[model samples]
Target: MEFRAKTVAESRVETVHIIRPTDLNDAGRLFGGVLMQWIDEVAALVAKRHSQMNVTTASVDNLRFLQGAFQRDVIVIIGRVTHVGNTSMEVKVETYVEHTNGKRDLINRAFLTEIGLGDDNRPAILPRLILETEEDRKEWERAEMRRNLRAKQRKEGFHFYGE
Candidate 1:
């Protein structure tokens, strides 16, 4: 079977949401879980767009919370495919908060791995990612490194379930 390569631009997705009082914590800041949910949703969209197949979240890495967002602030989430394997893709997600004064501050960044699934729910081959710009190339390289590290960890019997 043959699959057409897709550009990173083709899989890019951006979403914006306004923080509400209910979305905030006792300290009046946006909750980390809410941001993580948005990140996963956006990243899944990017993976599905890139592969044109059903995708499932395999893991999330380096989910850094850099800043706090207050209620009524606009939260912007951007997701783009950074790398692709035969059956998986890596997406980088960045979240920013726009204040009332129109200043945007980055609040969080993360990388998510998604595995493509066929109709039978088995691993499905994914289309290759075409890096169009220098930034895309750099991101691809970084994603490759992370993938390798993950594989090595798996080989070393690294388990997340705390068995």
Candidate 2:
């Protein structure tokens, strides 16, 4: 199969949702898991757009919740493919919240690695990620470093303490 290079903008995705009471925690702030679900969904969309094939989440890195989003706030999620490998791609997702008073704050950021899958349920080749802007280039470099670290960990048989 011929793989064509695609720009980050070509596969970028954005989603918006309002934080409802059911989405809030006991403290009245948005639940982290809920936000994570949104992030993963958006990132998956971005990966699918870039790969044009069925994909699954391989891992999520550096999911940091910088701030909290209160109920009734508008949450905006932006996701874009940062780097692509033979059968995998890394997508960076950022979440922001806009308060009723019109104040905007960054809530969370995460990098998700997704592996494209073929009909045989094996890894499938993905389209190349084209870095068009300086920011895109920087993100690509960072994704490469993260990928290398993950490989090293796997090679050393690293596992979480509880696992």
Candidate 3:
């Protein structure tokens, strides 16, 4: 069967937030959990914009903390939908540290996969992912492979129920 790719919908607002003491670790660095929370929050907003409904974090792939963010540093999170499938959306997210007060550099990068669910709470297909750039194409291929691999694993009884 022939099908078309579902390109990403325009996101309403690229949300931004600052790190507070509550979001920092005992060592005075931005906690990894804090970054994950922000990532999830932004990703959810993007997914909802595309899906027009509530969504949840289905999985996260290859999350790397390349550098550390201090308490006063601004952790900028950039998110976009890289791919979409029946009820699933793959969001590419990157974290950058804007610390003119400290030193400006990219602190981290990560890929997060979120699945859109219907009221019944099952995997729902949303849109087809359309790729343009060679980099976007590469990531789309990777997401496709991961999606297929995960589907195969699930069918083969490798349950990732909690994870």
- The most accurate candidate by lDDT is 1
Candidate 3 off by > 4 Å: 1-6, 101-104, 119-121, 148-158
The candidate with the higher lDDT, 2 or 3, is 2
| Ten-residue region with minimum lDDT total, candidate 2 | 154-163
Whichever of 1 and 3 has more TM-score, that candidate is 1
TM-score, candidate number 3: 0.78
Tens-digit per-residue lDDT, 1-163, candidate 3: 2234445546422555677889888888889998888888888888877776678897777789887777666667778887777767788877787666655477766677788777687766675666656877887788788778888988999888694
Clash pairs for candidate 2: none
Model 1 clash pairs are none
lDDT of 1 at 19: 93
RMSD vs true structure, all candidates? 1.9, 2.3, 4.0
Give TM-scores for every candidate, taking all chains together and pairing residue i with residue i.
Answer: 0.93, 0.91, 0.78
**Top model by TM-score, which number?**
1
Model 1 residue runs over 4 Å out of place are: 100-102, 161-163
